[model samples]
Target: MFRVLHRAGQSHDLTYVVVVIGVVVVHVVLVLVLVIVVVVVAVIGGVEVVLVLVIVVVVVVVVVVVVVVAAEAASAPVPIVLTTVTFLFGERTWR
Candidate 1:
């Protein structure tokens, strides 16, 4: 996670990139949902599409918020260590 942040920070435009990408993704999802809802409404003329669109919009917003939060937190350094241990066992008879 920190690796990604480090790379982004190196570019000296991490904040701008995150904002731009977030906006683009949100817009794309919003437009796609609107188009789908319109098509469904036209074909079925049912009110259920409104509920679906609302749910999709909420989900999109939540997803974007989560991504932004995660990315922002990733800017901090994280310590990770790996170690290998060998265990020796005496030979024994099975009961």
Candidate 2:
């Protein structure tokens, strides 16, 4: 992905680079959330009752976070992108 972005930047397609980066950030967040949920379930060892409760809570939290982020990003996406990037990359882009 970084390679693609570098190529795009060299070609001067800033719009395409921005779009790809946005899509990647969204996907990375979704995938990370999914992996975490899967790991949590596996560690719980399929306890039927607890599993169902955990799934419900996880779903609700995911939905809420998505909505809130979407709302904020709609107004100014740069901060949102920086936040997600900082989250995934341990490097702060936004102060």
lDDT of 2 by residue, 1-95 (tens): 56556766898977657766775776778678767776787777666745775678678867976886787678753445554565456453444
The deviation in Å at residue 42 for candidate 2 is 15
Write down the lDDT of every candidate, Cα atoms only. 0.51, 0.66
lDDT of 2 at 90: 42
Candidate 2 positional error at 56, Å: 0.8
Q: How many backbone clashes does candidate 1 have?
A: 0
In model 1, where do residues sit more than 4 Å from their true spots?
Answer: 1-11, 46-95
Candidate 2 Cα outliers beyond 4 Å, as residue runs: 1-46, 76-78, 91-95
Q: Candidate 1's residue-wise lDDT over 3-27, tens digit each?
A: 3345557888665445444545655
lDDT of predicted model 2? 0.66
TM-score of 2: 0.40
Q: Whole-model lDDT for model 1 versus the true structure? A: 0.51
